[model samples]
Each structure stands twice: as structure tokens, then as C-alpha cells.
Target: MAVEFASPPGNAHEIALTGFQNLARFTQRSHREGEYGMQALPETDVTLSAPRPVHHLGLLQIVAHESIRNSAATGWQYLVLTEDGAVASSELSIGTDERPPVLEQVNMGPFVQSTASALEGLDDIPDVQSGRYELHTLKIPALGAFLLWLRQLDGNADLFIVLSPAPNFLQAGRIYREDELLDALEGPARKRLEFDDSPRGRTEK
Candidate 1:
């Protein structure tokens, strides 16, 4: 597992991270007593979802745990579900006409405060404060479905999480949850997967 980061201007701290997943096969298990120890995988092509079982129990466990953690990320941009089925942080950015690829600029130092200062409706990550603040209740903002959570920036720009599926396998609008990604991996994913391509594929009835 390794961590990678990208920085774009304007935005505060955003992260890019890739860690291990428990996606090994069953044959790669060692048994002792009632518990089992995962065997070393000769290759990294271990599978976690069905149609095939996992070769490494440890990594699969990690992946499952990560799913739970990701399921709990109430706020944070760039929650990436990798093709290989790993969870990582991601960011979105837009550049000026002359700029190459502008990503959010943040500190490269360690031990960043979670409550980093936010820009009213602009920046989402907060600078580390003495305490954590959870929104007990608030307006729905935009009840209409969006590819990702939409944060309006004072009527100027906006920030969104932008991962979507292709249209052939599309369906209706959804509130969207992280677990739905599991469907995209093994079974038939919903139409909301490609909300960007099929904006009205699934609209409120």
C-alpha cells in the first residue's frame, strides 16, 4: 500500500492515498486451530468479490474494513474506488486557459489538522481545530441528484466529486451511497453509476 498526492491551486488540503486491500483467493490460506492465517500471494492479482473467491483473507478483510470506513466519510472530496478495488483519496480541479492541469494546492507537511480553514462554501476540508464539528441538521441544499455532493461557491464556482459509469448499464436518479460501488464491481450496477453521461437516466418520479 502506498500514498500518492496531487496539489492544485485555490483549494486547501486534499489527499491522494492508496493502501492495501484484503483481496486474496481462498487457496492461499493457512489453517491452524480454528483460525486461519493468510498465505503469501505469489502475484497481486487477488480477487475479493465473488464469481471468484479471495486468495488472501487478510487483504480482503482490510478491503471490507475500508469499505466500512469509506461508507462513513460524511465529507471529503475525491473518494476514489480503484479499478483493482482499493479505496483512495482524490481531488477535482479546473485550470485557466493557459495553465496545464491545476489541482488544489495544500501543505506537503505531516500532521495536518482535520479542521483546516474552509472558504465559506468553497473549501470543504477544515483546518484542524480543537474540536470536531458535525452538522446535526441542515437544508438539503439541492434535493436534485448529482454525480457527487455539490458545494456551491458563493454563486461563482462549484466543487463536486466526479466519478461516473458508462451509459449502456444506466438507470434512475439516486441519493447515491458508497456501497453501491460494490454492485459496479461484481453485479449489474445502477444507472446512477453514470449520472454524468445520463443526467436524467434516473429522475425523481
Candidate 2:
């Protein structure tokens, strides 16, 4: 004769608890208390492969900067490397008068002809001990600057390290839109409509 175990107390619709003990093994309960009180659960081993350090971090920086520059939109402006060998992209924009500059996270899409992609075959990318790279565009390329920049970038550790600039077109300190000019005007300038000067609107003087 088989021995009958007591069924867990619950309503008729309650699900059966078959592997409850097995599930409990994975989590731990705390016995102590304080600011550093009991942990939510005991640490468990996670079977994930450690990310390998990027061999070409510097080149990727250049590519990322170049990619942003070539982009049609004033999108991502910065390429950042995380301590754990991950690359993140960001964009900086001015907020309204009530707020400071805003830094937004952006996606690092494909790197075709981008500064980051330029490191593909080059073997001499600089080995930066610090994972965080701050890029500044020293000089906007004039005329054949792109070709010259390419030539200077051929495995040159020095150039890649120093010349990473923010890719916003306005980074050169020039406004691109007519509305931007009008927006900069204060008081009467901004309030006056260009149409007011048209012949149709002019009544003598």
C-alpha cells in the first residue's frame, strides 16, 4: 500500500507545488540586519563569457567621430568606451534657458567609412590604460583635409588620441540655419517680420 502525503493547503484552483524545494535552492534568505542588511539573495554563479578587451579601441573612436560627422542628422556626438570593453555612443545638445546641456545616449549603428571602422586592418591602435576616451576635434578639415586626415591616421597613435572632436556641425561655432540667426536676435530684431519690409507692406516711409 502506498503512503499518502498531506496535500498543501489551497483552493481547488491552486496550482500544485512540485519543484518548490528545488526552486528554493537557487535563492538565499538573510539572517543578519543593518544598513548592509541581509542580501536579497545569495550570490549565484552566472555562466556568461567575460567580454574581451577591444584590441582597436582608439581606431573605433576615430571611426565613431567620423561616422557622426558624415551623418545627415546632427545625431550622436561622442563615442565612449565602458570599463568592461563595451562602446556606447552619445549626443550633446543645449537645453532651454531653464535647463543645462543634455547628453543623450545613442545607438552605434553600422560603421561603414566611419572613424571607428578605419581600425579594421591596422595593427597599431594605441593601448589606453583608461577605458574612457574623451575626443575633441582640433581642426575642421579644410578642402582635402579628409584625405590628409586619412593619411595621418595610417596606424598613427598620436593623431587618433588627440583629434577626436564632437561631430555637431555647430561644433565649429557657426550657426547653420536662417531661423537660428533670427532666434539669436533679441527685442525688436526677433519680433520684426521680414515680410514687413516687402513692397506690398510698405506704405510710404
Residue 140's lDDT in candidate 2:
23
Per residue, candidate 2 scores C-alpha lDDT tens digits across 1-205 of: 1111122122211111111212223323333333333223212221111111111112222323333233121111333333333132333333334343333323233321233433332233333221222222222222111110111212233223111232322222231222332222222222233234546534311
TM-score of each: 0.19, 0.21
* C-alpha RMSD values across all candidates: 20.0, 24.1
Give the number of the best model, judged by TM-score: 2
| lDDT agreement with native, every candidate | 0.24, 0.25
Cand. 2 Cα-lDDT: 0.25
RMSD of 1: 20.0
